[model samples]
Target chain A: MQPQTAPSPQFSLRPPMEAREKFNRLTTWVIVAALLIWSWRGSEMNPMTLFRDAGNIGTLLGDFFPPNFMDWRLYVKEMLVTLQVAIWGTVLAVICAVPLGILSAENMVPWYINQPVRRLMDAARAINEMVFAMLFVVAVGLGPFAGVLALWVHTTGTLAKLFSEAVEAIEVSPVEGVRSTGASYVEEVVYGVLPQVFPLWISYSLYRFEANVRSATVVGMVGAGGIGMVLWELIRSFDFQRTCAVMAIIVLVVTLFDLISQKLRKMVI
Target chain B: MIHVTNLNKSFSGVKALSDINLHIERGEMVALIGSSGSGKSTLMRHICGLTAGDRESGQIMVNGCLIQEQGRINRDIRELRTHIGVIFQQFNLVGRLSVARNVCLGALSRTPFLKGLFGNFAKEDLELTCKALERVGIADKAWQRTSTLSGGQQQRAAIARALVQRAEVMLADEPIASLDPESARVVMSTLQELNRTDGITVVVTLHQVDYAIQYCPRTVALKKGHIVYDGPTANLTRAMLKTLYGSESDDLFGRKEEAPTIVQGAAA
Candidate 1:
């Protein structure tokens, strides 16, 4: 009898070489070469400059230590104003964004309506908060009022976009179910869409609130009131120590707001 | 009672429903069965006034009210819908809301906006919701978020919402298509029980033939936007199914031979 050899080991039908491997290698080298060239040409960033400026940088940083707590009352008042600005802006934006967001959602509004509304929101969001603050200050002639107006416009644009996308992504079955019950369009939105997105809306509003607190400081640069105005004054006077103190206070306030907002978001969403 | 005559619908130049006529009697359980694109859903949508078709050609009268005639829908279509309840395959319960809240939403048409905003549902409305939930055997889970429930429980909650609507007519669109075998049986039985006990007119769309046989006594089968069969479920034969679905009959009914014995009591 002829000896039977063991069946040959099974071999995979995979191609001997993968095209992706070659493509990845080529792209990796190209990316590294481009980044090296770009970094070298963009700025005359040499270690020598840092070495020369080390003493000045060190002194500027050192001034930040021993933050002046002498003006605690003034700092606290400015902090309260900043908090108020953020709260007012958030509340106003949230209220305005609901209707605008509904109008912008393709699933809720017809294309003719949603198209124009989305374009308006896009235009509103395209400009930065600082530009809006500058324009508001120029129009209203400076103050926390200008800051509030700027924050309102900026937050409305951002929140509208986020809220509309959330609304659009909601399941359609509930809407249809509500419609079948003979509910009006407004009632359908109130019961069907609102329940699904309320948590997400609250979460997004809190997140925007945290961001607005930080932006409220910079709005002061355009003559809008906040701790930023004092920091700007100190910087202009070359009072690095006082500038450091204000910065410390701003950082502390912002960090505390962030923690609160995060906790609230977790609780709701 | 609902009357539909010569209903026609088209989408993107393709006819989805054509010259359809149907009459649904009060307290009758009617099942609409069809292949994927057979116009059952389209016809059901028309009954709910969710879709507009060639109203000039079709006449739809609900409870002596003319809903559609001469290509025009009645302005009171919204009011008509308040008397009809609809359930969906997706359960359609708001995932973030509590089961009780979702059930309470059924009373939104009657509840004032301020009352709804403050969640101040009337005592009777709350009692009705609890009764509806109890009917579906899920009253214990009323306060839980709808998303936390199993698929069967969610569908039950959806049914409870419909029940709380106090609808005289209920339309279920593929209500059990997304459920497992046990859940599907439970949901179908719940609907059957409602129809038998409460005398609510039920018109359900179903993809499974066995379900139509087991629960619904009357079945209307549609094929290619046309009614191929309309008769008692007991009269359905294998040969009729072959004629209705053609070569697809083997795929649809072959599993019938291997079906696990359904525990009737478990469904209840």
Candidate 2:
């Protein structure tokens, strides 16, 4: 009788694989190494440098503690102004962004409308908010109004892109079903697309609002009227104590904004 | 009454429906039976004015209205759709919405925009929706999220939406294809009851000849975008099925028959 033999294992019969994959892996490693070297060259990212600078960081932290509550009245007023700027800027951005978001959505708008609106949004977003503030300060002559306008334009662009994507990802069946029922295009969008994405839109808008609080303070550094302007002046005079106080106030305000926004996001989404 | 003459539709240079002619009368349940890609769904879509074709190539008249003529479709096709209901295989329920809301959508075209925005459905509309839910035997589930329902229940909810639309003609595209045999029978019986009791015109596309014979009085068969047979359901013979579906006829209809009660139990 013939000797019993084991059956061969089944294997894929495709080619041994492409050299491109190996080349790609090597190229990725090379790019990563080059990026690390390039970043290290100018940043002085050595551990020794960090250790040597640790003392100065500690000194700064020590100065920040027992924060100067001496100008409590002035600080509270400035903090209120900063809060107002953020709130108004975000509200304005939301008003402007919603319509733009609808117009920019490829699924909602026709190509003729969407393409132009997207390009317009791209151009609007390309300019930094600080730059817009500087331009508006020059035109409107320095105030929270300029700062609010700057934040409005930048946030509108960002939120429009995000909200359009949200709109685009909605299930198409309900929209089609609604349209099939003799409903107008506007009605279909209102009923089918809006309900599905409204929660996500609210969540994203609240997230942007949190970011805008930080951005609003920074824009005030360019003489747009907030606590940042006072902090900038204190830093310019090298009054580290008062600067630390302003910084503390800013952190407290931003942290509060973050907590509120998080709560609202949870409720909405 | 609806009339379709010499209907032809093409997609991306491929013919999906060609030289098709059909006439559907009031209160008749016609089943369009065909294999996959045989253009049965496409034909049903055209009848409801969801898909448009060259008007010069064909004429479609619904209730004395010339809906399509000379490569042009009527602008009032939406109004035409109000008189017809469409049921999809997937049951197309918005997952997050309640069953009542899904049915309420059927009345939205008639309700003012502001009313719809606040979900201020008219009392009569609400009553009709509830009645529709009752008719489909899912009234107790009307307030529940549609996604919570079983496949059979979801399909019934879809039927309720169609009923609430007060549609005179119902077009079901492979309604039972996705259901188990028991659920399939339930849905088919529902359609049959609608046709027989309410005098609604029902045109449903089906894959199995057995269901078509059991539920529909008339049958239309298509193969490769062409109508191969159109006659009474009782006339569908093994030879005709063999001719239409080729050697796959046995594979299509032949099966180890299960007890109908077992199918019902599975559905429940």
Candidate 1, A39: how far from true, in Å?
Answer: 10
Q: Residue-wise lDDT of candidate 2 within B7-117, one digit each (tens)?
A: 988888789889999998999999998878989998887877777875446788876777676557788887777777889888866777888998888887788878977
Q: Per-residue lDDT for B1-268 in model 1, tens only?
A: 9899988887887888878888888989999988788888888888777777774457888767787775677898888877788888888777877999888888877877678656788999999999999999999999998889999899999889989999888889889888988999999999999999999999999887888888998999888888888889999987889877987666555275566788865543
Residue lDDT tens for model 1, A64-114: 777677787887788788778788888899999999999999999899999
Candidate 1 docking DockQ: 0.56
Worst 10 residues of 2 chain B by lDDT: B259-268
Candidate 1 Cα outliers beyond 4 Å, as residue runs: A1-52, A62-67, A138-142, B54-57, B70-72, B258-268
DockQ score of the complex predicted as candidate 2: 0.44
Q: Clashing residue pairs in candidate 1, if any? A: B55-B71, B56-B70, B56-B71
Judged by DockQ cut-offs, the docking class of candidate 1 is: medium
Residue pairs with backbone overlap in model 2: B55-B70, B55-B71, B56-B70, B56-B71
Please list, in the order the candidates appear, how each scores on TM-score for chain B only: 0.92, 0.91
The candidate that achieves the highest TM-score relative to the unseen native structure: 2
